[model samples]
Target: MIEFALPDVGEGLTEAEVVAWHVVVGDVVEVNDVLVEIETAKSVVELPSPAAGTIATVHVDEGTTVDVGSALVTIDDGAGAGDVETEDEEPLVLVGRAPAAAEPRRVRLGASRPSDPPGPGPVIGHRTDAGPRVRTKPPVRLLAKRLGVDLHTVTPSSGDVVSRQDVEAAAALTSEPPVSAVADARETRTPIKGVRKATAAAMTRSAFTAPHVTEWLTVDVTRTMELVHRLRADRAWRDVRLTPLVFVARAFLLAVRRFPEINARWDDEAQEIVVPHFVNLGIATATPRGLLVPNIKDSHLLDLAGLAHAIDALVQSARAGTTPPAEMARGTITITNIGALGVDAGTPILNPGEAAILAFGAVRDMPWVVDGQIIIRKVTQLAMSFDHRLVDGELGSRVLTEVGRLLSDPGETFLHV
Candidate 1:
């Protein structure tokens, strides 16, 4: 029997919630067939069977969050079935809250060290005589034990004491109605997991760590709007998906190319600036799951039509929750289209590990001074927030200037392309 442990589907994701199972005990499955869907910090990923086999056991129930090496299922492929075994280590026990003598040790399959606990939540339960005791009521302690939760793993919602609600909340990381979640119909409680949880952590880290500087520019984009209409009418471009966003994406790419230094990251570890020649342009997309910034790889290499198609496909996949984890990695810079929701402008936070992010606001008809004459023109606002450590105000302003110039007169910008 092959014991299938939960795998790290995303980049170093320690745990994932078992969103769904595609097979059950005694069911036949083929190699590469999807066995389950597990949601990591970034996205939902489908795990495929490693070997053709009959499902022998589903160790983890749906809605449970399991560590990367925790046993998820067992499959028998005409091979001998045996008891699931653990690594060469002591039987796992909950630290701070020792299990009773009669209770059996729950062995996590791939646990290497006691610190590497194999269950779920903040810290998995493992045998250790160290660490401060987590304060909780006896009934809450019993509840944690029954649900296989470690008291040390649950972060107390209020102060130091862990309540029954905290225990239940830990159990329902990805599933179940949050116990005592409603004090009244006036309020609702949602378990922070999957995308939402990850977004909060990332945004917090970015907001506090990076010294951010924001710059704004307003430009008349009458020519860019005219170009969009012309492209829609053109036979060659009729089939291509085009929008103001596509133009904005193109303009951002051009600006980055002009100022390659802007497409760099501050490597604090190495104490150096790391710049890549290639640009993985990330588009901030709002999905049902959450905000996903799945990027287009080598966007600098694609032409206008190709970029439009890529942008459309990326947005559609993100909204449908089908974007792969790899597509969301290694983003150098980003663009958030707040205009899609009719917002004027926003100070977009820099995507973690990125140097800058641009916010594109709604394009509207506004009075503009052209040749010293006030007239109505298609205008829009652009705002960019950049890491002040890597991007000085002058460098950031120059990049924004180029982007605005390109968007204001895209026909001239394309002439060179």
Candidate 2:
């Protein structure tokens, strides 16, 4: 029997919520066949079977979040599969691809003897004081144990069965006030997990650790709008979805090239300001799951058309919640387009480990003075937030000024390109 424990899918990932299971007990599976889908703090990923076999037992149910080394399922993969030797115990074989960082717990399977008859216990449906003997599954019981929550004290919101949510809610009340502490009866409690929880933790760390300074610049983007119009008219560019954001991204890349220091990180351990030649430009995207900041790799090397295409693809993938975990990692700088939601401006927070982030505000037609004459011009507000530990006021101002200049006049952008 091959015990399949949940593997660590990415760096620093300790646990994942089981979104679904494709194969149940008694189902046959081949190597590399999709076995289950689990959602981590980063993204939703499908895990494949490491060995071909018939699934003997499903240890975890859907919607249960478990640690990396927790047993997920057991498969009867014939008799030839090798086993890892252990001290004074029966030979056990775990999933081949399980991360070495987390060792699967040794599980003793079945009864010690055939006549033992499933151990001595009060059977299910046997009545107790608190109705039907506190109905719950193994996974829920395990969760309750981990959270220091007693099942008898939890009230089941969904029918009679105690769910994972119930366990989490009960735990929340004991620690830092969440479910039971609500003052209003109309309020609903949501367990923070997956993307929401990850975002909160990251933002909190970034806010407290880094000294953030945000600068704003409102610029006349008439020339940038003209460039967009011309691109729309061109037959070659018709296939591409051209927006002000594409221009903003292109301009930002140019500015980063001019001020590479803005595209760097502060390594406190090494006591160094590390600057990489390549730029992984992150685009902040809002999805059904949560806010995701998936980035494009080597964005500095891409031309305007390529950059546009890359941004489109990245945003689409992020919104659809299909973006790979790697795409969301290693971002040098970030851009959040609050304009898409019609917000005028915002002081955005820096993505953790990134030196800077740009928040592009909504474009509007406003009166401006040109050669001592008032005229209507296309204008937008640009706000940038940078880590003051790495970027001084002058450097941050220069980067923002360069970006504003490129947007004000597209010809300058072309020359820089």
Candidate 3:
């Protein structure tokens, strides 16, 4: 038997959470078959099987964090059951860095007895509270059994390894009859990990680490709305989905060109500013997993039609949870559409390592003064948060004002119709 261990993923990933298991025990798999799905801090990656064989056992449960060198699965490589050995002696085999990395090398440590399932956490031996069998002291296991709680379904309050506390919490939900508990009400506690946990840590650090100064501008976007309508009617843009946001994105790129400093990052270590010549415009998107900021590389170079296609592809991939890690990193600036949720505006948090973030509000009909005359116009609010260390009051204000100006007049800001 061969033991497949987690390999070094991109960006020096020391550990990853097993989001799911594609193959269970006793399933026949082939070389390069997708074995599991893992979520890193940056993105979700699918790991492929290294060798073709029958899956003997899975070392860790779904939603369990694992180190790189730890064994993940064991395979019957047709070498017979006697060929099994320990993982330390044999070198782990792995492919290139693109796909999720896992060091899959078979070492036959022999199978666990029928009564004992595979160990949790690392493959060697341990118990965890994730998806597989729940791990705990003998007394806690007895408590779970007595309370009729399926150890597999119970959530652990502490480490991946289950504790008596986790079992007690699980028992509390049923400590009282369900019908009676419904009247009393109860708190459903969800384990904070994976994407949700990572997002919280990142947002918290971003909010506190940077001195953020947010500015807002309400703009009359009547012309921009007209442009969106015209583009939708045009056959030339039939393939691309053109919304008010396409124009907003283009306008933001133009504004960045006018004020290049806004498309830069603050390098505190060097005590200098680092500016890039190209723009990698990040579009903040919400997914079932969490909020992801996947950017278009060299966005400034794309025309209107190209930009629309890029935005659509990026957003669709992000929503599908397939956005690659490369696309999420090194973003110069980001734009989040709070309008999609019927919100008028928001102060969006900046993506870590980026200079600024802009929030696009919903476009709506509102009372306006057009040349000293009362009129109803299409309008939206633009709110931006910038790192005060890199972008001062004057520069941040200029960027927001420019974006508003471009939306106010499409012909002046947008290129290629």
* TM-scores, all models, native as reference: 0.77, 0.76, 0.74
Local accuracy by lDDT, each model: 0.78, 0.79, 0.77
User: TM-score of model 2 relative to the true fold?
Assistant: 0.76
Question: Evaluated with TM-score, which candidate comes out highest?
Answer: 1
* Candidate 2 structure quality by residue, lDDT tens digits, 1-417: 677788767668899988656665545676666677787887777777766666656778666899987888776666433562111132122224432222222223322422223656532222234333467654455456546677888999989999889999899888543322233467646578888899999999999999999999999999999989888899998888888998999999999998899999999899999999989999999985689999999999887788888999999877655677788888999999999999989999999999999999999999999999999999999999999999999999999999999899887464234
TM-score of candidate 3 to 2 decimals = 0.74
Off by over 4 Å in 2: 80-185, 412-417
Candidate 1 per-residue C-alpha lDDT over 241-348 given as tens digits, one digit per residue, 9 for 90 to 100: 889999999999999999999999989999999999999999999975689999999999998888988999999878766677888888889999999999999999
In terms of lDDT, the poorest run of 10 residues in model 1 is 87-96
Going through the candidates in the order shown, the clash numbers are 0, 0, 6
Ranking by lDDT: 2, 1, 3
The count of backbone overlaps in candidate 1 is 0
Candidate number that wins on lDDT, 1 or 3: 1
* Local accuracy of candidate 3 as per-residue lDDT tens digits, 288-310: 56788889999999989889999
The C-alpha stretches of model 1 lying farther than 4 A from their native spots are 82-183, 415-417
Candidate 3 segments exceeding 4 Å error: 10-13, 54-56, 76-184
Report model 1's TM-score to 2 decimal places.
0.77
